[model samples]
Target: MSDELDLLRAADPAPAGEGPWRDRPLDARAERGLNRLLHSRRTRRAGRRLMLRAEAAVLALFAVLAFTFSDAGSSPAVAAPVALVVHDAAPPLSLDALARSAEARARTAGAADGPHRGSHLQSWYMSMESGPDAAPPVTVPEERITRWNADGSGSELVVATDPRHPGRPVIHDDHGRWRTVSDGKVLHRKSYPAGSAAQHGGLTARTKPPTDPEALRAHLAQLYGGADGTSTTPQLLLALSSFRQEWTPGPRETAAIVRMLADADGLRPAGTVIDRLGRRGQAYVYDDPDGPDGASDATRQMVILDPRSGQLLGLEITFTKDQPDFKITAGEVMSYEAWLP
Candidate 1:
């Protein structure tokens, strides 16, 4: 049994190269060849791994570019500008130049024509003051210019009062042509009627109503004190009715008002201030003269803002006397309407 086991062990081939197959222990040259084969296999595997990584990187870059381009393509197209056609013979003026010319025209015409000839009407109402021991406050009904018209040259502006009086219409014929007549008496008479048109140069027209209510209101407020204050409510209503009839505010007027307000310096001070209604962004609180006394009144102006653009909307003025002895008498809202040229 021992001889059989020894023969079987000897027949096992002497562990790869020890017997007949190798005839000797593996030499250094053979060992080197074997090592080279192993190295080649490892290098080939590493190369395959590197190639996979490179392919993945390239794929990732392409995916990023695809996403970017797709997103860009999905964006909306920009809107094109609309064309405007002018019928008058005058050359088209740039917005800025037109505004300057319009202002100059308004000033010159206002001076020549005298006060506006709109019907002067008013109504009275009573309300309580804010103080603990205060008397009832007097409030005049809302006064508005119902109708207004400008001569072809814009030299004469004829305005009919809301509460038109029983007499003849007020005429402001300052620029000749009987620009305006009130009860046979020419409220405004033009010295050089024929030549006055030349002073206005070319007549630029408005295309739409003014959108900025704030500036319009402020302008109207400034002009408020200059007009006649005595008239009936019905008459004033009539004047307001005329505003829609005679003058249609244009988009250019609105744009002009917005620009004016934006250009106004120091409209709001550095520090935060509460408005008359104690709300943020409601009113701009400022200082102004207080009637006869040297004392000053805190003037709070409520501004109407455009909801979409967050722009100044309109303005309301309220005067409160800081002096302990004096009472506040003026607190009114001034509204503005854009008149088309």
Candidate 2:
């Protein structure tokens, strides 16, 4: 009994550092932990014994049970983790249907170009709320107008603005479109580009895109991937995205691309969302190769679709996990773009 009492005394943990709880008796849970500690210590001090091993097992089991049956009021009630359920009511895959509808529109649609103008205007809206800089991110709600037309010929415009305000944001007015980079103490400016989602594919009066889905898919696969086709989800997504960046698919081509996308792995419907152009569109997410359940550090690519006209409206890239490097929070918009004709 004396030896046991001495062991208990040594295992006492009421006070971690000779404080108020130091001399006090341990709680039920604490007692169990301390008892295990005491036995563990005894095993170390004296050579391992079968009797001691059995006793240690029995004590460990009791400790676990004590934790299991701990009084609800005595300890904080633990909430059962809720598993997030997404896509429960989502529609079945409809890439084929969407493509067919797009092709129908193409049949009745105007020529790829309204009229070959001397110069075509390229207006791109960008939402780059976060970037890879160390400073607090600035929102760039601005449009970039390049002299280059849809046919892709033009000189680069270089405008000089105040370059001193790296930490401050530059905003462009919708009415004026003029931005002030810096004015000594007063400083702000406009924004720049996020990659456009649905581009005219840089197809001009001369370029021809494949109308067959299989051919289109292979063409795009070769364009984005090389001789060895990319079967991975992220690669296919980026490849399709690359096609949209330079070319706005004609109706038939758009339909074929949509059909091919149906079988492409890693793409899943994320439901409807409004594009930057304020158009209602269906949103699809390309989840990371990692498990879908991991919210943190998971990354996704977004493609917005116009179901009625089978047009690809926008594209977005966001993170499910917080990105400290970019000073972005989880679910924060990384970059979004809506294309315009």
Candidate 3:
């Protein structure tokens, strides 16, 4: 029993005493909701399997219970949904304006033209696996750094850490055991020899990207590898993200990327916001309701750029609707990547 409790502690996503509601007792409505959830057909089936794995079962139960009673503490439901307030008063910056400014900044900075050889980034991404034995869906946060030397050798390092919550236990799955570890725990580290670093499917790694805005747009689509007859917005965003993973864009390349995005259809300026790395950036968004040509998922994609230099800052994808089978909720972030300058 002691060992079991320790495992539960390690797998707890939210440790006790963290949130305002942690100390508050559940209201009557919330208690009733929890009872219904525990006895539901799906819960019973899951509970049978969960009995074999106390940690995963409890983790899944907590996730569902939290969502079920999230609004229980608030006032009773009303006829209409409440409207959210936007505090920022400044108007959203237009894509065209951002493109022009980025180009000007690139030229003024006289940055080298082309992709840089490395990147340092922090990321949080949802990992979901489905099966009788699969663990619950989880979002993992970590920091990754990759560097390449002039001799073509490079190294990669990944650490489990969330900068926003320093010293907090970082959750990770080791084999089938969901556990927590101290921040900065080294998850992976490796060094590569010359010629090995260039082995990637990235567009920029294959060929030099043109600075011409129209040409770059076409280049992105040509290399996107999406099915024909589908919207390129989703594919382009993925390709752009892959580009960031392989290489950081230089000033000239940054300017071209901005200009190319400016002309892409369906993307609109989405006001400024602070990225996960604490840098303020201009945001642009594209919503894909039916997903790519044949896909059925609905998701929102966003690209954040440094407002001053127009360099790419971050990329995010989020689900806009609930997926009950997968234990996903609306407005849940699917993935986020913040590239450092």
Give residue 135's lDDT in candidate 3 (0 to 100).
Answer: 36
lDDT of 1 by residue, 85-117 (tens): 112233422323434544444444432333222
Candidate 2 lDDT over residue span 209-314, tens digit each: 5777677666654333311243455545545544454455556666666767666776777667655455777777786734122223466667777878666676
Error of 2 at 106 (Å): 3.8
Position 211, candidate 2: lDDT: 72
What is the C-alpha local distance difference test score of each model?
0.28, 0.44, 0.60
* Candidate 3: regions farther than 4 A off: 1-88, 109-114, 130-135, 194-206, 222-224, 227-230, 292-294
1 against 3, candidate with superior lDDT: 3
TM-score of 2: 0.49
Tell me the lDDT of candidate 1: 0.28
User: Highest lDDT, which number?
Assistant: 3
lDDT of 3 at 113: 58
RMSD of each: 41.5, 23.9, 14.7
